[model samples]
Target: MTETVEPFTWHVAQDAIDDLHRRIDATRWPERETVDDWSQGVPLDALRDFVDHWRNHYDWRSTEAWINAQGLSTTTIDGVDIRFLHVRSAHENARPLLLTHGWPGSILEFRAAIPRLVDPEAHGGTAADAFHVVIPSLPGYGLSGKPTRHGWKVEKIAQAWGVLMARLGYAKWYAQGGDWGAAVTTQIGRQNVAGCAGIHLNMPIARPLPEDLAAPGPDELKALAALQHYQEWDAGYSKQQQTRPQTIGYSLVDSPVGLAGWIYEKMWAWTDNQGRAEDALSRDSMCDNLMLYWLTAAGASSARLYWESFASFAPAEITMPVGASVFPKEILPAPRKWAERHYTKLVHWGVLDKGGHFAAWEQPEVFVNELRKTFAAMD
Candidate 1:
């Protein structure tokens, strides 16, 4: 495995763009949902409006330039290509932080937060809060190479991150993530990655303890209720991905509208929005994120991560310093008490007033502040 981080840029062909518009134009849309609310799914009208914006008003060039300006590079690790944004801060003593993204998310999730992290003085923070940030698209997501074999689980990705940071010449660093990235960061702490000082997570990997299940307290009851809701109402996508990723991959890869609705539904479900996902995340950002999937044909390759690691949350007690922020609307915002069962050196615990699943993407200011405070306290 030659460790070479080659600089990369987006040069999407005109034919691909034309095909995307063609597909969007030719979409055979479904009728309105039976319910007024999103009980049935992303309503037909909402999806049509989203696709309209994506087809007409959204500027992929702006997003492409923004991303390419920050600098992107790829390196082969574990027989796969890892695509990442490597932005070194102007501050020489800035700490190195490895950020990761998860499903229904791309490297786009971290775009707003990256500048603030790398140049803290401009964004309500001192030089001390500055960081050299490295944000990688998860294996099989975004531009990263999809795994050709069966063993690319969260732990595998975690080990690869360790290798990546070391290769980038960071002797000591910190990590943070939510969703699958959280799962990988948890593995980094659990595996005790070399020179990793500490880690933070928005969605901690914790389940209801036997005792908590038997006798529910306030936090325990909250965990239980979220669990029940997920099992009953929110887990259809997971079950489908877990059981048959290849089947749905056809729809996702073939139809731009199919791909948009698949992710658009999750956007509505996960964000702290007022009836529409645009209330929390801007239309341009959402469309930018959608383009990554549409262009890469990543529907099944990305979904396969669920097939690999969904059943095994891989709960284990980690001795490294850990910090967490529980947003109000995280699908399963694990309480501190439940988290204590897995993180032995729980250094910082923050329960935020607002925000939801996509912490960095949804509430970047709050997210960057948490990282600063948590890593500062870890030392």
Candidate 2:
């Protein structure tokens, strides 16, 4: 049977938007955090200001228009309908590249990175640097269909991505991702199936060995410190989602304010923002991401991915060619030696000075350049 792909357009019901406003207006206020800084989480004032802008000023229609412009399409793979932005390059030599986003993010995370990757000539690069970008909404995230059954782990998603690329006639392709996206992409390389040429990750997963623990270097020590900080201060959401997604599902699914607050804390913590998440990402863009969650009621479905795979996040040895760009502000920065231990065929390793977990969203130019270089090394 021939593959079917219909163009998708975005138009949220007006009633839903009105209801969102009513919910925001009726939000039961929480007491302000005692700390002036973000030590206790997104400060009350910051969240109130963000919620106010979203309720009163953010243009959901404009965001919908932008999504429609990105060449949206939908097709069912396995048992799920995946929504994606497929931007083919004008250049004939463009390589196929699949980009994925993690929790608290949708395909909108790559809004800035897409045009640059697909049309590098206009941006900065030559035809050889162009990519036919395939950015799919992960199962249970964004506009993709939520899995009705269990077992949609990262590895399963990796296999489904192979099917997606093959369905689109991409026998050979490159994969890139951050956060959970990285985990899935790593699994792609681990499976090494259906002509995956290479994989690139902004947040590569690699654990330290006993020897390294006994005698840590500067980079490894710093990475460990960041890991400690994340476990101690930034991992409450992870713990909750990995253990009981259904428990928090009630609040996240029912209350838009709850969903927004949950994601806003991540944006504040993960981005390379100097003081505030809005400093690095535009309020409009942030609201656009938030709306992806709200419109789809994806808060619980997205979190379920954690429950599926968080326990199996152990490092696996991969023989396929791999490259990684380690942003300085990554939640857990990987030392070159650690990456080399797993990605034995590690070809490109870039320790960037700026950017963070949301590499493409936070720094598009650098992110695109890193893609061009990393995949080129894979070539």
Candidate 3:
């Protein structure tokens, strides 16, 4: 698959930031009853505080400059344009590692850890562990162009990544991902393409009970009980995305505040936010992510993925060397036996003491260690 390299530039135009400022200042707020908690949606009070900061103090140009400071490149894979940040090691013998980002996250999440992963020496590690890193914006997210057709399933995305790595002349490489990224990376492992040596996942999807493990041990039963409880209360967002994404996406596509609330709610509910999202993640990082969605107008495109593949992606077996770093507040955690039912060659599985769905962003050291151990063992 021949790929067309594009002129990739990271300097976001000044007009774009001006436009965001105008939108933030011109917001028409709605009144809400004092009694209504966050259950209804984004709290009016929180949006106001965010909007005030965004309008008065936020610096989009600086953010753009910082992103530009990191190396970036663009390429067209199977007709869809993809933008990525490429960080290569000084060691010519470095291994290639393709890192995938999930929903509401861009290549931005990995910015802090890229140098550490690629060079390692500055971070007090050996160059022997160096990796040539490729962090792409998932289709319909950030810089990647939205898919025009309906076939942008995880399988297709995984294949596209295969083409991507091969285009870069990597015949064998390792992979890592979280959230929907884990889904795509896991599919790559299943496909067992020539380049994908092994995979490490932070957010492994819940495996359905195998007949042997269906009869719950006390611990398994507790895990299952906890999962069931979450589904009842917290799974509504998944149902909405999988069914009527466009309807909800309309508001999110237009309003940055709306989009922030929609995504931030999940970040708060899913992560160890300690009841305040700002305590865990800064408003700037949060806004940077929301801005990526707004600038690209990817709300509908992002949600359509759920509607497209949710129905067809059945729980099935995967036959590849795999590792999972199970964070405490992740959507699900499978015991070794249960995980083996799906990941037949489950070589590494660890119970993380901290973090949640956004493990890499929150607990990069823990995530990095697990990833290093898993891939190193396979090598």
The better candidate by lDDT, 1 or 3, is 1
Question: Per-residue alpha-carbon lDDT of model 1 for 104-203, expressed as tens digits?
Answer: 9988999889989999999999999999999999988988999999899888889999999998999999999899989899999989989899999999
lDDT for each candidate structure: 0.90, 0.89, 0.78
Clashes of 1: 0
Cα miss at 57, model 3 (Å)? Answer: 2.2
Superior by TM-score: candidate 2 or candidate 3: 2
Rank candidates by lDDT, best first.
1, 2, 3
Judged by whole-model lDDT over C-alpha atoms, candidate 3 comes out at 0.78
Question: What's the distance in Å from true for residue 125, model 2?
Answer: 0.8
Query: For every model shown, what is its TM-score relative to the native structure?
Result: 0.98, 0.98, 0.93
lDDT of 3 by residue, 1-379 (tens): 2376545786666787788778766777788746666666667887778777767877776677776666677888776888887777898888899999887677877766787788778876787778899898888888888888778898889998988888788888989988788888878887886679888888766554576355777647766866786788777877888999889889888877677767878767777667767766778877777777888889988888888777534444678788888887776655566666778777899887788777877777777778777877787
